[model samples]
Target chain A: MAGARRERDIHAATLELLTEVGYDGLTIEGVAARSGVNKTTIYRWWPSKDALLGSAMVEADVLAIRLPDTGSLRGDLESLLRQIAALLTGPDTSPVVTALLGAATHRPELGEVVRRFFADRLGRELPMFERAVRRGELRDGVDPATVMDLLAGAVWVRALLRGQPPRPAYVRETVDLVLRGCTS
Target chain B: MAGARRERDIHAATLELLTEVGYDGLTIEGVAARSGVNKTTIYRWWPSKDALLGSAMVEADVLAIRLPDTGSLRGDLESLLRQIAALLTGPDTSPVVTALLGAATHRPELGEVVRRFFADRLGRELPMFERAVRRGELRDGVDPATVMDLLAGAVWVRALLRGQPPRPAYVRETVDLVLRGCTS
Candidate 1:
């Protein structure tokens, strides 16, 4: 019980530091100080600062996402994307996500962590596309992975590269565009 | 004459250090040492480390890209995206681009620089879309900027998030999908 509590405290502190200082500036010492956990405790759990930050990011962004199935491909996509937009633009989560993306570029292990995180998330969401195919909304052999990449990628570019909040209208347009392409 | 040579030497050193040490580890003193230029000269020109890095990235990536104007919309898009894929996967430029992107997250000025760089590149490529519209390859009212975002965003997601190189087949598929969506 105490161990679980300590882990949560460490994750919470790590996330706070990620948003506050970003990945480049984030350090294990800062997390320890912020969480009031001993530095040795952190080292025992996570061998390096990158490992800790990667875990914190996955815990914050990936684990918590629950994809909605709204009985139609368009509905499911729009709903899922809207949730994504909110998360990407969320006050607390956006910086953390951006920091991880930035860190992933320089660090190969962290890149794997991020890639695995998304791959798992996309895997979880695969059923939505399968359902769409069953409903005759999508053609057979349509690669759900590619479609997911396009949809999510479109939003990510806007949010991260363009520095624009993923507005609802933009999300709708992206969904409509991808759906049109997939269906046709 | 000497001033131009010094500037080139500094930029070359900056790019080299960016790939070697990354944005977080790169320091003005290090750049000075690598280029054999005075630290004061770097400060005189760039104002900050972020500024120098941003400039180096732009000089490396943007100024070098040449968008192909292949007459057909499909041809133009495929060629352009292929170039993007090569650049993103290129050993020398990829790290610098990634570091700049990561640095841009915490540094607003660098973000603006990246944004402006893409915006300008998109602007240069808008003529291709316009030509396609003239040839009835696309609808009259299609927004070039939005289409550009979707295309570039799809590639960026794969390259950055998925840790996958944008393969030629993937690039072709993206172009076809976007074209299908945009036309229909």
Candidate 2:
């Protein structure tokens, strides 16, 4: 129990540092100082700074996402995309997420963690498509993974690349467009 | 002519050091050493490291993209996306682009440059959609900008976020899906 509590403290400190300093400026030493955990302990648990930050992101943020099932794929997708947009645009998470994204480009380990995090989130949302397929809202063989990528990826571009907030109307339109493509 | 040659050498050296050291470790001093140019001259033209690198990216690489007009929206989009995929996955440009992306998160000026770079590319491709609309291949009121974001953003996610190469087949399918969404 003590170990688990200490791990939580480390994750919290990691996130705090990420938000304050951004990814490029972040270091294990800062995490150690902030968390009051020895640098050696952090190193023992996480092989590198990338590993610790990635793990902290998964533990504190990514895994917390819950996709709403509104009894229809479109409804569920809209809800989920909205949530994702909110998360990305939120004050605390936005900077951290953006930093992690930038860091992932240069670091292979961080890239692996990021991919796994998305895979897990996408995996959880797969059942929404399955239910839609059963309901005949989507054609057979419609890949839920691709749909997730399209929806989430569209929002990502607007939010991250364009520096625009993913508004409700825009998310709805994107969902409609993807649903139209899948259904027709 | 000598001045132009010196500028070209600087851009080349910048890309080289960007690839070798990654973005965070890169410095104007290294660039000057690699290019045999004075640091003061580089600073005279570019105010900061971000400005210099962003300028180098624009001059040396981004302006090289060329999209073939296959006389159909689908054909043109597929060709453009394929080119984008290849560019992102290519060794020479990928690291530079990735580093720029990460750097942009912390630097608003770099972010502006990145946004303008994409916007310019998208603007260059908008005529293809216009041609399609005139040729009756697309519905009236189908927004080219949104379509661009959807298509390019999807590829970006697959390439950057997922660490998956944007294969030709996948690019084609994405185009087909988006076209279907817009048309039907």
Candidate 3:
């Protein structure tokens, strides 16, 4: 039980270091220092610094937050985007995501983690769109997968490149644009 | 004259290495070795590897290709998308963009370079949409910037994450989705 507690302690410290120093600047020594644990303890649990961060990142609140079903695609999407906005603007998580993506250059597992997160989120939200299709709210032959990509990609572009925080209105607009097919 | 010539040779060699080694694996030592230029010269010109690649990326055909004016928004967009497709599918430029974006996680200049590239491209393309608006083809309050981000972001999401290459038809669908607003 103590060992398990210690391992959790190391993961928490790793996430702290990831947000502070970023992926490139994060070192095993730094994690050990921050966590008040021995470097050997960190190494004992994870193969490398990447593995530790990757494992800890999986436990981040960003992944744990469940998507709400607001009974309308528009409502659910707005809520989803608002949640993402909160995550992006919230303390440390933005930089954590940036660091994760940045570190993924060398560590392919990081990319896989990011990919899995997106896929999982998509998986949760996609059924809503599919329900819309079944109800004929969407056009025939509309690929829910493509729509998912577009919707998620829009927010990602703003976050990753524009460095602009997500706006609830922007998410609302995106949901409107995709669902109704953007009528003037 | 010789100094300028040498710089061009070095930049050219950097592109070659960019294609061969990608942005992640590209090192100053590798650039110097491959280009046959001294490492001192590279360090003298560029402060770091990201800086060297940032400049080389700007110099590459990535932004050098011109967007065509087909006298219609649809035609012009198709032309632009084709150019983007060419750039993405062309020799090493897309991967270079990805690599540079990968580096952007750690390096500020690289991120700026990417942002500037998007801004420039978006700046040029926004007017085309505006022209459509003037012709009453689009809504009066449509946000061209948002629209641009959506289209470009979709393409980028594919490039950066999905391991799926951008196709000309994907561009067409993107244009179609956005144009749906304009047409009504």
Q: Which stretches of model 3 miss by more than 4 angstroms?
A: A1-14, A17-59, A181-184, B1-59, B85-91, B181-184
* Candidate that would win on TM-score: 2
- All DockQ scores: 0.39, 0.36, 0.31
Instruction: Please give, as one word, the docking class of candidate 3.
Output: acceptable
**Better DockQ candidate (2, 3):** 2
User: What TM-score does model 2 score on chain A?
Assistant: 0.83
Tens digits of per-residue lDDT, candidate 1, B1-184, equal: 1387787778788878866786668898999999999999789899888777666655543336786777788999889888877777787667667767777777776777778767767778888877887777875446666667777777788888888899999988888777664221
Model 2 residue A11 lDDT score: 89
Clashing pairs in 1: none
After best superposition, candidate 1 residue B164: deviation in angstroms? 1.5
Better model by DockQ, 1 or 3? 1
Q: What lDDT tens digits, residue by residue, belong to model 3 across residues B33-112?
A: 87788998789889787677767655554446575767777777667766765665555566555565667776666677
**What lDDT score belongs to each candidate, Candidate 1 first?**
0.76, 0.77, 0.67
Give the least accurate 10-residue stretch of model 3 chain A, judged by summed lDDT: A57-66
TM-score of predicted structure 2: 0.83
